[model samples]
Target: MTSENLIKYTQLFINNEFVDSVNKKTFPTLNPASGQKIADVAEAEKEDVNKAVDAAKAAFSRNSEWRKLDASARGRLINKLADLLERDITQLAKLETLDNGKPVGDSEFDIQCSIDTLRYYAGYSDKIHGNTIPADGDCISLTRKEPVGVVGQIIPWNYPIMMLAWKWGPALAAGCTMVLKPAEQTPLTALAVAALAREAGFPKGVINVVPGFGPTAGVPLALHNDVNKIAFTGSTEVGKQIMAYSGQSNLKRVSLELGGKSPLVIFNDANLDEAVEIAHGAIFNNHGQNCCAGSRTFVQSGIYDAFVKKAVEKATNRKVGDPFGDGVQQGPQIDKASLDKILRLVESGKREGAKLETGGAQIGNNGYFVQPTVFSNVTDDMTIAKEEIFGPVQCILKFETLGEVIERANNTQYGLASGIITKDINTALVFAQSVQAGSVWVNCYDYITPQTPFGGYKMSGIGREMGAESLEGYLETKTISIKMPGKL
Candidate 1:
């Protein structure tokens, strides 16, 4: 698909209507692959955020059609949205590839994942239930699960539609009205999906999308007193700031899926060929912009040299070009700032004495493209080894024993995911139990499904994203106790 064929939706979606920002401000959303302007998007500031919050609050009120509808009806509406998403997956994927600079194939995968996530949550809309307790002394007691009044969601540029699904699915399934702030860099897909939500017959003010920068739209959403909850997927620093904002305001419930420097360990007994492929895809997928990318790869000393050679070969052979081009496995970074950050981190890796195996430089002149970089002989103290580079840079660290590798892997403050490639079941089980990460992939990497809960340990933020656990974040529990007179 060409840029001319792609559709642009630039207005803020509020109360089921596309409208200009209150201040009439706008910003240019760029095509990161060519450093060109894609469209002029509406820029939402604090005033716009307030408007969205008010809309959501009105939709969540008792008298509103959204709150008065049956839970099954709500589920049907969500399912209709999912159906619409599946029908328009092609256009949505192209828009995502154009706006976010991810490969078209990867964008398709993201769209499919989003569709699956929405369907999964739609199945649970009416099934969200509380407990009924058998009480004593003729008193009946029960618990009810009710929706949190209004939610504010802020999503990242990478996997924009998928993250929107992750946050929106549970919130909608739990019957919460929400105002979403899509990342300023890539708001096209979110705006498009908001239109789909409206088409699927969602009530006015039940869903809203506000596209703007973090400091303006995001901060106001988090700090809004009327918003009962906030869900965010982004950097650990920004996640922390949102948590503080929540506390300083109404102590709104906050759920965050933050950064990671996840470790992928390969043992000597593993299948060498399979391990090499998994490790390469784990670190280099989506140009390694994934928060759960296995950036720190720990290989056994017995096969470290061979693994490094094979990894370098794979990185050197991978295609990096336009996201829309055929057979392009790697694409440009999201923007110039992200491109500069990745380059700086790669330079730090070289200066800190990590051996650059094969690729380590920028690729093109006009856009933000980086070479698939591999650093061998990397120590734990190196800047690249310790930081979440969020780029297609791999740091291979050699380990002598299982115990040592586990210790080294758990040393990082952020623990989102880990992977172990080993033939021995005993070793896999031991490592899985000991790792501090939220998800441990045995003989696999990045195998996420809608049924599985995704989150992290330590500073990797709070709460889960996908699965049934996510629905709980958007719901509140109320217990009712009744006293009955039996023989009076």
Candidate 2:
């Protein structure tokens, strides 16, 4: 590897130290751009997971430094980590791009978002408060919010560093110690950040990162009896498995941000150019690996044909090449398996009678790349419309009216995000209210801010990830009662 893109910190980070796994096992993390092995990451199995959890549990104990630290002091430490991350943004972003195959610009944005997330939660550390209730004159009643002890967080590969911030920010802000499992495919960035957490003077075991496969390390962390909570961002299937493991084990508090087949609606009143641009970004960003990607594009009949033409042109012109290359908007899929799955789903779309308007084949001889594929004349029954393809593929379906489109959009097992492009405020409001997704964007798509709460409804996952609402998930409510003397 070049000096600018060298891999660093491949060992498991436990108790604020980089250490070898119990078995000393390692897995090759690939550079998806060249389909080459970038580095061998230390693999954490059940034994290593147990060690990390034990450390986290101890750190979270009342007598430990982490728990004994004042809430504002904890916030300061998290802010310090954010400052450290800001200083190393370039290096961390490069590592993310090298390992995850997203464009460098995208990686930089992710790092900035993560830093902002840390800062946001730092502000909340001191503000997390309890309430005093006026009860019967004879009694004093109050409720306090306390951290949920040790937490196990499993973050997905698509947005590795950002997802880490989503899970780590609140858990730490609430005074909880955690054992984090970065996705095996993209563990480099998470490992690098653990060093920063140590540098920021976080107590040993306050933040631990164990890199390994889901079954080996992830399941153990999720099922660990000492872990007070499990926060995960991944596929719906795995989210379900984690929930089941929670039930089978300690019934830990579980929070999930799962999969989505989000819809982007284009009403006739929308600016054709703007709608086309937004829709292209909604699905094609991150190679469509986003859990809340707007994969389903619904267009009103008045602009149906026009929208398809412009969308096809945009997808065809999108550059699919090396993520590090200048002006390359689209990058390779995460790995060969993901690329193959995307291609298979594309074929199914064609078989199911959706018109393949443009690119649907893999690109280049090396690495895992797929052309930005688009399909027109898609019906609700098509596999591409129903399933979370999680690739750079967009399915465009025509609708006649608002009521019909709302029904069609809500008819899915996933309800993570939805968007509408319309100039009419009434139309946007109606669509936003009627849509079943957790987040609804008007005249925009995929506009995420750290201040806004993000999550989903129905099968899309159980709880919120960002904003004040997220802090509630990492905390527990305890009610206190004291009887007063009759002399009062």
- Give the TM-score of each candidate: 0.99, 0.99
Clashes of 1: 0
Compared with the true structure, model 2 gives a TM-score of 0.99
Candidate 2 wrongly placed segments (more than 4 Å)? 1-5
Q: What tens-digit string does per-residue lDDT give for candidate 2 at 1-488?
A: 24244576999999989999998899999988888888888999999999999899889888999888899998999999999999999888888999999999999999999999999999999999899999877789999999999999999999999999999999999999999999989999999999999999999898999999999999999999999899999999999999999999999999999999999999999999999999999999999999999999999999999999999999999998888889989888999999999999999999999999998998987989999999999999999999999999999999999999999999999899999999999999999999999999998888888789899998999999898999999999999999987864
lDDT of 1 by residue, 352-445 (tens): 9999988888996988999999999999999999999999999999999999999999999999999999999999999999999999999999
Assess the local accuracy of residue 238 in candidate 2 as a C-alpha lDDT between 0 and 100.
97
TM-score of 1: 0.99
Query: Which pairs of residues collide in candidate 1?
Result: none
